[model samples]
Target: MHGYTTDKDDYLKRLRRIEGQVRGIARMVDEDVYCIDVLTQIAAVTKALQAVSIGLVEDHLGHCVVDAARRDPDEGQAKVKEAADAIARLVRS
Candidate 1:
């Protein structure tokens, strides 16, 4: 979080764009847009989300994990595992 503090505004802007994309998807569904076109937008949204997830993961590793490692070995190990699990979940999604 600390590492991301400086880039928080940028992140928020990106997320807002993604939110708009989701709304666009909903509108497309309501309008009965072509199936393939809808799927293409979905893929775009997915990639956008993954990009955000990767950024957050990087922030966590750089800030939280580093802090935890500095504070204590056990905490550091826990933080690393948590980060790994986060990546796993993102990959699965």
Candidate 2:
């Protein structure tokens, strides 16, 4: 666990937006919407999630990983490797 932090309000806003998108998707499903439209919304939600994940990863690297690297080279390297793995997974998805 890293001592990572972010603006609470911004995080909440993003979550709320994502929630709305999810609800919209549910509504589309209930209405038996077109296949393309449903798929587009699903893609939007996936992209949003990825965006959030990337932002957190960037923040962790900037703060936690940088701090750790300054204190211990090995720890910093480990953090970098972990972040790289996460990014690779994200890219694959």
Candidate 3:
């Protein structure tokens, strides 16, 4: 049904792994782990989240935006704008 349809499970698995990583970071804090070590884990989690965001953005452009464009040029343009706005927000974050 969509670009990510086949890989939905994979996304979920990755997200779950990231969740575990977050929990681990919490544990590290609880144990008073070294600041650098905690920062390393934090960086890893940030990158993992960025990866997921990029994947979703790709799926949006490849599937939802394309489908909308096919249905109507104006609608497609709107989708493109929306996607751009989303990317901008993500970049700002």
Top lDDT prediction, candidate number: 3
Put down candidate 3 lDDT per residue, 68-93, tens digits, no spaces. 99999999999999999999999998
- C-alpha local distance difference test of each model: 0.93, 0.86, 0.95
**TM-score top scorer:** 3
State every prediction's TM-score relative to the real structure: 0.93, 0.88, 0.94
Give lDDT tens digits, candidate 2, residues 1-93.
443355556767887999999999999999999999999999999999888887788788888889889999999999899888988998998
Query: Model 3: which ten-residue window has the lowest total lDDT?
Result: 1-10
After superposition on all CA atoms, what RMSD does each candidate show versus the true structure?
1.1, 1.7, 1.1
Pairs in clash, predicted candidate 1: none
- Runs in model 2 deviating more than 4 A are 1-4
